[model samples]
Target: MIKSKWTSEQLAWKIRRHGVEMTHLSGGSHLGAILSVADIIATLYTNVLNYDVKNPKWEGRDRFILSKGHAGASIYAALAECGFFDVEELKTHYQNGSRLSGHVSHHLPGVDFSTGSLGHGLSVAVGFAYALKKDGRKERSFVVLGDGECDEGSVWEAALFANHFRLNNLCAIVDHNHMQSLDFNENTLEIENFGEKWKTFGWNVIEIDGNNHQELKVAFKRVEEYTKDENHKPTIIIANTIKGFGIPFMENDILWHYRFPHDGWEYDCAVTALHQIKPEGVEDRYTPNSIENPVLPTEKDDINNDHTFSHTWNTTYPEQMRRVDAKSGTNEKVHNV
Candidate 1:
């Protein structure tokens, strides 16, 4: 166990709970993807990254990019818990006119890059790492990519570039959650010999159970160990993870990739599954609007409500693209309903 004021379990639990709440409240997709990497995110925020949330951009801080940006809520929860923004501001996720778009955005402070298009983030991360190296900065850059994204040629191009340039400051993590959007990765595209693929590209590869906190903590340390050596190269950690990890019902279920749980039975079950033993004195944040007296969101309401949400910069994915969730049914079939 890496030394920290808070245990990795505590951070993981907080991230899992908060992630579910954000996605549930906002009716966002990729909740499974969020859960899958809870432990990894917690480990990084708690153990690896040298960051001060209060100073969103410290000159010497380590930079992390969520290449699988559909899981933006997971990073949002982590940032909030780490004090990047008020925890309450997360409720505005995916809401119209809110700064928190469905996809990851740099508009929010503490976020180094905005990414949603698959196979793009690793390239951006490489650029950041190269710049830091050129400036003779030891501060590292880390990028987390989804397994499904490996199919993109652009991803390979970035990989080759990082290896060619000897970007020892770069560390790439793959969330190898077997299932993709509609089916397993094998159905979409198979990445045979994952570790070999990275080694062949001249990266130092270490495969670990992505959901295991201890493994994640150690894997990052290994990267540091490699960078100090005479023959250093860019490193990649292939993390074997489970989609929809925390909730028993959603585990390994690909449907949750793009489908939001319904407001009725599915929502209740998901929330219940997320908190098997409810935390003491904490109000349930995923409570859906009552059917009888539905409380609809109004644009005029809370326009001035500020909870440390940043408005200093703009991201490529405009706020206009955020999908407004309707208060109704779902085409997604709720299991055991």
Candidate 2:
């Protein structure tokens, strides 16, 4: 793996910032899901996983899967920062002909699995772990799942499989934000004794504040040491996080799950919330489209993909917020903007 200059905290902020920009520009939703897992993704990509940005398909690399694909923007952001792709390409997210889709897509260079459907990622991770073990490979297989996705019976089935085979090289990270879709998980379908349930399934489990980078590093170290010692039990880290994290107005609010960052006040505020550190000289990079940008043709097929913008946006961009270089097409980095 290439050396990472940025620490986990820096990576988390970058992921959150990129997520807000991606959803706002593309008129997409799921910002709450993405923000909730930024630190988890940051920790994994920077501290845990063994990966190379240039050699993404390296056979010896650890396999990382995003089971909760709805929060895919975090993956894209992390990968981009890791040099898997150009950061400027992020603007085309969810746009017509853009490679970055709302859900995780394997078509991207760094992604290992394409999953929008819940309950499948853990199962696939199990299969990968089993295969790696059979081949006598020490490479680990990791999967990130959601607390809400625990409702799928298949998740339990995979849990049993992971324990049954004693896949020590497998690690599952659960983003337990508690809120899912229209309401909280308790109100929707309660999975009481969430941690105990995993323990009962015969897998080693670690529970920690998902947003705390330091705690996350320690948890990953424990799991890594256990697996490296040839301990033949899969491990799962249940990371507790707040939905719409880093954003004051959107935090713990179910409305942000499906809400779009409208062009004017809404978009600006959303970006502000995602950006906790707006250092000097880092002007806003996103230009609110004064005219309605056409949505991708495939959007019509999915009702949740629908987007509508009011004419609340202004045509003129403040000089301070401008990012596009008139002479050169390349965008300027406004302090990692």
TM-scores vs. true structure, each candidate: 0.80, 0.82
- The CA lDDT at 123 in model 2 is 96
For each candidate, the alpha-carbon lDDT, in order, equals: 0.79, 0.83
> Per-residue lDDT of 50-104 in model 2, one digit per residue for the tens?
8888889999899999999988899998888888899898888888888899899
Give the least accurate 10-residue stretch of model 2, judged by summed lDDT. Answer: 302-311
* Clashing pairs in model 2, backbone N/Cα/C closer than 3 A: none
TM-score of 1: 0.80
The segments of candidate 2 whose C-alpha lies over 4 angstroms from its true place after superposition are 278-337
| Candidate 1 clashes between residue pairs 3 or more apart in a chain or in different chains | none
TM-score of candidate 2 to 2 decimals: 0.82
